[model samples]
Target chain A: MCLGIPGKIQSIRDDAGLVMGVIDFGGVQRDVCLQYVADEVQVGDYVIVHVGFAITRVDEDEARRTFEVLKEMSQLDELEWMAEAAEQGMRGLEKPA
Target chain B: MKYLSEYRDADIAKRLIGRIKTRATRCWTLMEVCGGQTHTIVRQGLDELLEGSVEMIHGPGCPVCVTPLEQIDKALLIAAKPNVIFTSFGDMLRVPGSDCDLQQVRARGGSVKVVYSPLDALALAQKHPDKEVVFFAVGFETTAPANAMAVFRARQLGVQNFSVLVSHVTVPPAITAILEAPDNRVQGFLAAGHVCAVMGYTEYEPIAAKYKVPIIVTGFEPVDILEGISLAVNQLEERRHEVENQYVRSVRRSGTEPARALVQQVFELANRQWRGIGEIPMSGLRLRDEFAAYDAERKFGVGGLKVTEPAACRAGDVLTGRIKPPQCAAFGTLCTPERPLGAPMVSTEGACSAYYNLAKYRTADPAGAAP
Candidate 1:
């Protein structure tokens, strides 16, 4: 229940008195309660859903930015580790003390 | 899968691991407060990769693990009654009460149903007007709004037959309690992101300043967790302690306002007893006076039920991070998932169950060899 999934809103409707919508998770569609997030979401927007309720609307720009930053930082660190490892290997090959 | 698969990219995870290892000057004890994060960390061996640099102590954030035994006993008492249909999330059925679980109650002719949502139970109540429908509402703040909505809608629709047995807890106080422990070594925390996505990180701000520990609101993925660790390590290395948002994509400084408003309307904070750990002041949520009629404990008259933890279970120690699950004498011998001696072993999100389920994936060295 703690693992909320980010799903794209496919359509919106009012079920009786509550605001509801069909959200597409990957390809599977599940009806979700959108009343909590009605003010912030629209068709094609992404929201983090838990137990059939949309808790918070996902920021498309923010999501892309976070991934970009992480990707860049990780790549930079990978190069640093490789350089450190190469220096260590060179030292290992030097004359034994 | 746009947001899902990218976070699990292996190259990025490896790099984050290397970054965290390089950043930390010495071993730092940090606790990930959500069971979901624990599962990711253990499954990906993130803790082992940063072994010497970080000690990831699993916190008591699993609602099923921390739900007081007395509440379980009350649920059992209410579930076994005639004409009352007990509805709960699938996981709660297997959790053992004093002598039997909800499944056993169903085995003995009780009407126990597993529901994915509280609205389903409300629907059942509407369908069978003659019977009463009770939902076992259990989770952190991530779940409270949905449960509160059910109650709010029930009252609005004039559905008198639906009620809930709420066992909801919050994260900030739990962090406070862990910090106040005299022997605590936790220098930082990876706050559960989903919880903050509901309650926001504002509550954690005071906690970070007062305790002087970096609390990074973290997501439930290998790369997210590794980045959260790296962020916390950087703060500690520089003698800085603050609440930072590692999960900026899903969470905001102020969480969803509509959800919070509904929860505030239907529930209020109360002193609650954790299943293994003792009572923490105002750590749990309960129905407000206006909505007291929707409380199952009040409606069914099972509120007086109580039970104590078994002497053999070392769950208290495990839940508080004093010892790992395997450190307990009864970890494997007396407390298997098939027959859990304590609450932590009962839920998949639980740290004990996480240890038991993912033990094979872990490296041979229990001490966690350096990366």
Candidate 2:
């Protein structure tokens, strides 16, 4: 399975020298192995957990930037659609003849 | 749902689709090398929406679907033993082996358990020191690190009862296999984002160069996939072949170093056999010689069992994108999620299962994979 779900790390602790933590995935919580991302991730940080391991700590700023850019692109396209629709409306007023 | 729900934005997905349509002068056949992305494309009808612009070929990225029958038989053999407690991810339970599936063994009083992680199987070994716990470790690079850690931990703490039946396959080699095929029509690829998150995109640069194909490391969400398709289409339009990263937030160029390092420590490259596609040299991973004691095949003596694939199932064609699941004569009638003739139907992420589960694409959908 290649699917990795993003979740927030609620708490962290060492289990026999491995960095283990409880990851809250929106609501449900699971004990995820944070040893791979131990250096960069701490409590309250978001990470992509796959098969009980935190593969990477999600970059919040970068994530917000990516989403905002998508929204902006959508907004720009909406503007384009409005312009085309208005132009069509203007053309229709030229009369059936 | 902060990071996830935002990526499913419908407006963004539609805009990206519009952009991809505008950029393509001719229909480009692109393959998404992860079955998760295939599921997203089929479930959302993303392929249908961008019909003429792009053709999405489902690649052999489902681990359950591609894991060779011999390995499944070994897993079955081990599970059937009275002293062995076989554990695997839930999805692998129904994958049909040569004789039968792991679920059948479980039905016949076998101690088979579905574990969320390899570590959970290791925990079972610790809990019951008398029984031998064998975890059927099968997946791609996204799962290698976790399975590696389980073996490392077992050896570190002297947990002798634990071992793993590793059938891990990497993505790049499989991609190469597809591009090298004589009838290949794929011009670009959407690399599995999670796989890149573990192994990074550096390995893909050389592939893009030599093959002259664009490889976009993409995520599993609708918007993420559409953006990946958009990037690949843009590159094709300009005749630019390179490795692009559409999933910037989670994946880094170097990937998670610790995970890669640990996986390197535990596993090594070996010739692997894919169920439908036959053998691809060095496409799979096996536990290193140092961990032979933890290798289930060595411990159980089930390493030499080989069986032929049933002729009724055209998994090879479906896996290689030569034909769509619905195109298969046995797809819905002879083979199904209920009584799967092959692994593709049993696996949730398999292309066949995706096509079967998504009824909207069943009626010769123009956007569905070509014959």
Candidate 3:
């Protein structure tokens, strides 16, 4: 089972000589390794995190195109609804910090 | 959720279905080569939507389901050993070995733990220097990079206690195996997107050309799968056999070179046995001789132990998309998730598990009725 989730890199740093980062999975944040994507990833760049490692950098244009295709198919309403909820969830998470 | 939420749009799924219906000239049987794709298809009722227009079959891509029975038995033996901390993903703990599962071993006083990553297992080795830490590495090319990095890190740190019981597999071989089958009904394939992300679609070109089947690298979301199906249908109608990328957002023609390099550096190709499906030459990744110390099989001496699958289970047929999960006499009766007769019933990504979890009503009465 190849279980990978998209996460945005919140911060990047070296942890004991290994490149690591704090990634935000929507609202939740966790530590991820940048060993595989060290050259391509930036602080704000999105990545596909699989098994604690950032396997590849998520292309901005491709991600936008996917959403745009869905939008063209008249499917943004549900995504809009979810985005609001996710934003709220992120706010809720931020309140603690 | 950023790259994920938009792919599950219901309206997009409907539109994709409409496109697939328009493109379909005749019935085309398409097989999705990933258990993750199967789960999404069942959960989202995509097959029901494309009913009569196209036939979607599940492939032998569930790593846990296809992992050889003897390998599980070896993992069990190692897990049961004293002063050994066994680590694996949550799914593998429930998968049955020859006689018992890792959960049973844990219940009987074994230190089997579920870890999110092989890196976590590496951390376990660092923290527990006195004990042996063995990560049951089970997955395909999608996971090889991560597992390879873990072993690489272990060697770099000189972590003598760390080792991995590898059962790594690749996707193209499995596709070839399916296409080579005598009764193979798959005209086109929806390749696993993540595997393509790591290994790219280059390898698929030859397979598609050789088999005269369209191989579309697809993602796991609802809309993504629908689009993938639509692409396959278009190919079938046009009589085209080529590798297309429906998940261009993540996949490329060449794939992630660094990850592939890491995997190639740490592992060498080997003949691997697929449970129910038997062995396929050069289908699996094994630790190189240079990294032999990090190999748990060699470290624990459990590579020779072997076992046979139960006679009643027809997971072989189910895995190859020859039949649905409920077609087996033991399905839902003798092979429920709680007491699984096969690995397909155990892993969450498994086709049998997906059918049972999302569409168990199909099992209530098996009168040969189509779902």
Measured with C-alpha atoms, the lDDT of residue B43 in candidate 3 is 61
In angstroms, the error of model 2 at B371 is 24
How many Å off is the CA of A50 in candidate 3?
A: 0.7
Candidate 2, residue A82: the lDDT equals 22
Q: Write the per-residue lDDT of candidate 3 for residues A7-72, one digit (tens) a residue.
A: 678889987778988877545566678878899889988887776788878766544454444333
Q: What is the DockQ score of candidate 3, to 2 decimals? A: 0.25
Residue lDDT tens for model 1, B325-353: 98999886788889988878887678888
lDDT of 2 by residue, B243-305 (tens): 999998788999999999999999999999998899998999999999999999999988888
* Per-residue lDDT of candidate 3, residues B1-371 (tens digit): 11223343656766878889887878889999888788777765678778889999999888889988898899999999999999887778888877899989999999887776688788878888999999989899988988999999999888999999999989999899888888888899999998988888899999999999999999877778988999888888888999999988788899999899999999999999998898988999999999999989889998787787877989988988878997999988888988998899987778888788655644554442232
Q: In what order do the candidates fall by DockQ, top score first?
A: 3, 2, 1
**Candidate 1: which docking quality band?**
incorrect
Q: What TM-score against the true fold does each predicted structure earn?
A: 0.88, 0.88, 0.88
Candidate 3 error regions (>4 Å): A59-96, B1-8, B360-371
- In candidate 1, stretches whose alpha carbon ends up further than 4 angstroms from where it belongs are A59-97, B1-8, B361-371
